[model samples]
Target: MKENVQQILAHFHIKQFQHDLIHWFQTEQRDLPWRKDKDPYKIWVSEVMLQQTRVDTVIPYFYHFIEKFPTLDSLAEAEEEEVLKAWEGLGYYSRIRHLHEAVKEVKEKYGGCVPASKEQFSSLKGVGPYTTGAVLSIAYGIPEPAVDGNVMRVLSRIFYITDDIAKGSTRKKFENIVSHIISHDNPSDFNQALMELGALVCTPKNPSCFLCPVQRHCRAFAEGVETELPVKTKGKAPKRVSFRAIVLMNEKGNILIQKRPPRGLLANLWQFPNDEHAPTRNDESFVKEISERYHVVIRSMERIGSFEHVFSHVVWHIEAYKGNALELQMGDETNKWVTIDELKQYAFPVIYQKIWQAYE
Candidate 1:
């Protein structure tokens, strides 16, 4: 069986594959903002933003982010709140938080130059295997393989590897294969080519083998099983949690918002007063919870609408309401009153943004 695996691996002519792949990439790679220059900082930022996010969605954010913090020094100097605000609409708040923290460390420890060495770079916060390989190979022409899910799928089909991609062991196998075959002539374009191929042609379903640059080299395509090679198991469904988000407006029309805990999901971001509750909880219960929790007597409560925000682990079913803040019976450091016009200055979660856009 091991000998048979070796035969299959040898069938994939690495040199020809590299030439076809990289040539296709040089011709067809998308004109992305991060691809314009090989600035490691920008590449790092783009990678973070691109995590589970669509390329189209990340484009404008990348432009805005680069404009706001053009250099690692500027990003390192930024306050956490300002960074969070800049990354407001981009979900996965923790990505930016970790990147911000890591950038500060890079500034202090590495003099704001992103470390090219794998050991030093991976030691930084949130720098994982994929990130380390990507930065090093792309920035420094290292021949290390950046085997992300996309690369895994592309490889699985090309080599007819039947391992389940959902398994970590399978990922390790693909990474090993990539390490052996990745281009020494141009590692940057080779890695990007694998990713681009996965994105454009070798998609999750209905792979476009006809348009594939390396179609003649694909083992799965030869057997007419290209779509069936990269097997993956489904993960557990997210838990559903209910929340009642109360927009408490003072007589002057100033809305009250609070800061999320500094350590959990949506950490350090601002939001309208909201807390998890049982779905069976009524409007009176919501008002009571807010009044008791914030020490405010809410009057004229009117339910606007319901919206759902799906996180990886949990789905938030939010019920939004508008009410008058009759009196401030107590005060908390985390809560603040800002005018509706001033709300734009604060960075709320995307669910709140959706609610406000609809409500406004």
Candidate 2:
């Protein structure tokens, strides 16, 4: 490890760089609420919530979450529906579900405390390598490296490593390097400083190289190629999809909303009844199909609007229609009519939320 650190420092002149980075971090690290506590539970929650989520966006959610379920037991006790409702509008519902399950496992299996060992904790629900290292080192002062996207970018650029970042071997290489370089005495600070440097100075686009503490030591800076480091293979393009969303409303102003099937895209979420094919000029046929499908009678049909939404893996072209319900029967077990006030009770996926807002 000493040899590795020495080589990195000698190659990139990192001693002064690390020193200055630590100094800047002391005074300039964002005053986030999560930074105030070293508790592994709190840190773990914050880390999970922050994954693929921006810092500013996670702030309020974190505070609200901690306030709601401060202790591991509380989170463990929460119902999945209740938890998902609390996590409404947060795109990745799976994270919250995993988090809830993990807390329950921790409470029942490991007492109330989050496990301290990296290997043990990593095997827990939703506890991946990055998260395990982050919790162990930041909360328990273990000499482990938490290599997230920010850390990866910083390392790749500073060290000028040209490996494909998406590959598993590249990640392991970074992890091994970080394991060797992180200071054992003050593991938390060292780990955080690297992350902070990446977030603040080694940003994805137009990094602030001039303000960086380790600018002189960065290989990308010397070579004028900071933007190009951490190369990754391209993934398949997002799939495109189309759906016809039926906004059925009665004279009473109650709108029909149905819960998605228990699994697959937007699982268990509330949405307007919809189909794949768009209606031609005579949308009456579309309404008739809905009536036949749900065993309901459609008294009238009116076109509201058309809109589209994009998700991580698919794009939705939704054709929305307003119809008057003549009869009510459930073809799908999860269908229901909900008032505007009642709509707030259940969690709708973000895409549906956008359409709901537009309807309002």
Candidate 3:
């Protein structure tokens, strides 16, 4: 494998390639908020948020998050619920949960400083290789490679790599290649450049190869198979799951919302009461289910409407029902009755937020 890697490396002018890529990045990099400073905490938050989310979508959230939790100590001192609330509408609640847990760990174990070493950062709750490398290199100017999907796409097309990116082994292979070609002097810019190139020019479908800085050295471009080189097997389609979501209102104009369990998808976030089974048209059974689950009885239920939410691996086909409860339940820790104004304070999943907006 070492000999094979060497053979692959022999094909390119590594130093020149790195110089060109870094130069391109310096001139063309986007003016993202996170790029303003090399703070480890800021870099860490941005990297985590960027996972499975787009740059444009993350900008405002990033600004808001930084304003709220300006420092690692501030993030560590924040309550888990508050952190989740700050991360509201950014799907993938687990990221913020893990980030909060990791921040607390850093505060407790590392004296409120984000650890610079690989071993220390890796030990944090959700600090994986990609995040560790990104923060260390970008924040500390350490010579490490942050090989994310964008980097993978850029490298794969350049070298005409045919490995399945969805596989773990392939990722390690890409990481090794990244280490081999990474600019020791400017690892942060070099790594970010590769990602930027992939994002803006060397795109997946319609790569702007003509504008690509490293197009002169791109193997797939020479071979006329740029788009076809990075072979990836498709994952299974998202499973469709249907549910009946109940929006229970009381005479006081308060609505009933429930907190999800501590563990699982959308964990600990607040949402309207929803069940997997379809409720009866009259919603007697639905009211009964809500009553049984939360220990609260509803007088009647009116079918509101239906909405669909799609996650990476699941699609929620939700039928919404609105009704008035006999008594607003507050005894159950997970259940609450709050006015719409008060509801704004709690963190709700985006799907429920949409429902609330439409209902309003």
Candidate 4:
């Protein structure tokens, strides 16, 4: 079995494959903002934003982010809240937070320059082998492999590797394979070409095998199981969680909002004050709970309806209730009353934005 696997891997013509892929990429690669230059910081930002997001979705966000923070010094010096606001609607708030933190490290420790060596780059927050490989190879011309899901899928089909890709161990195997076949002369174009092939030609479903540059060398194509070659186990379903969200409105029409804790899910973003419990709680109970928790009195309560937001691993089932606050006995440090115009200044997740729109 080992010899057979070795023979299969050895059959691929590395030089020919690299030549065709690079040639095709030069003519066919999309004109992206990040690819305009080899600035390491721009590459880092683009790579981070591209994770779990489509290219079309990221293009506008990329442009906006760069406009706001054009240099490493600009991003590092910016406030966290401003950064979160800039990253609003992008989801996965943690990515922006980590990017901000890493940039700060670069400014303070590395003299406002993105590190060129693998060791320094990997030490930055949220950067892994894939990110490190991408920045190094693409920006610095280092001969390293960036084996993301796209690259894994492409190689798995071409070499007919059936290992379940969900496993961490399987990723290492794919990375090793990429290191072996990556073009030493033009590592940047080589890695991007493989990823582009996976995105455009070797898609997850209904792949356009007829248009593949290396179709003649694909083991899955020869064996008639291209789609089945890249096997991956299904992840567990997201768990459901319920919450009771309270929108406390004063006589002046200012609504109450609270900043989430500085860690965990949706950290430091603003949202309506909420408590986790069964969705069966009535308006009175919700008002009473708010009064007890924050020392505020509600004169009248009305059900505003419900909203659901799904995360990668959890689904939020939120039941919203709006009420007029009759009295404020004590002020909570984390809670604030803001007008509708001021609400726009703080970053709210899409779920909260939808709720606010409904309320308006």
lDDT of each: 0.86, 0.78, 0.85, 0.87
How should the candidates be ordered by lDDT, best one leading?
A: 4, 1, 3, 2
Error of 3 at 188 (Å): 1.0
Error of 2 at 30 (Å): 0.6
Report the lDDT tens digits of candidate 1 across residue range 1-360: 133446667756888999999999999999999998999999999988888899999999999999999999999999888889999988888889889999999999999999998899999888888888898889889988898989999988998887778888777787788888889989999999999999999999999999999999998999999978688888999998887887788887777888888888888888887766334378877777788777788878888899998998999998888778865653365788877887887888888888777667
Q: Model 3 off-target regions past 4 Å?
A: 1-3, 277-282, 328-330
In candidate 3, which residue pairs clash?
A: none
Candidates 1 and 4 compared: the better one by TM-score is 4
Better of 2 and 3 by lDDT: 3
Candidate 2 or 1, higher lDDT: 1
Worst 10-residue lDDT window, candidate 3 = 276-285
Give candidate 4's total backbone clashes: 0
Q: Report the lDDT tens digits of candidate 3 across residue range 1-360.
A: 233567778868999999999999999999999999888899999999998799999999999999999999999999887899999988888899999999999999999888888999988887888988888989988888898999889988888788888887787888888889998988889888988998899888989998889999999999999979678899999999877887877878888888888998889999987776444444566667777876667877676778999988999988887777766345467888788888888899888887777676
Every model's TM-score: 0.95, 0.89, 0.96, 0.95
TM-score of predicted structure 3: 0.96
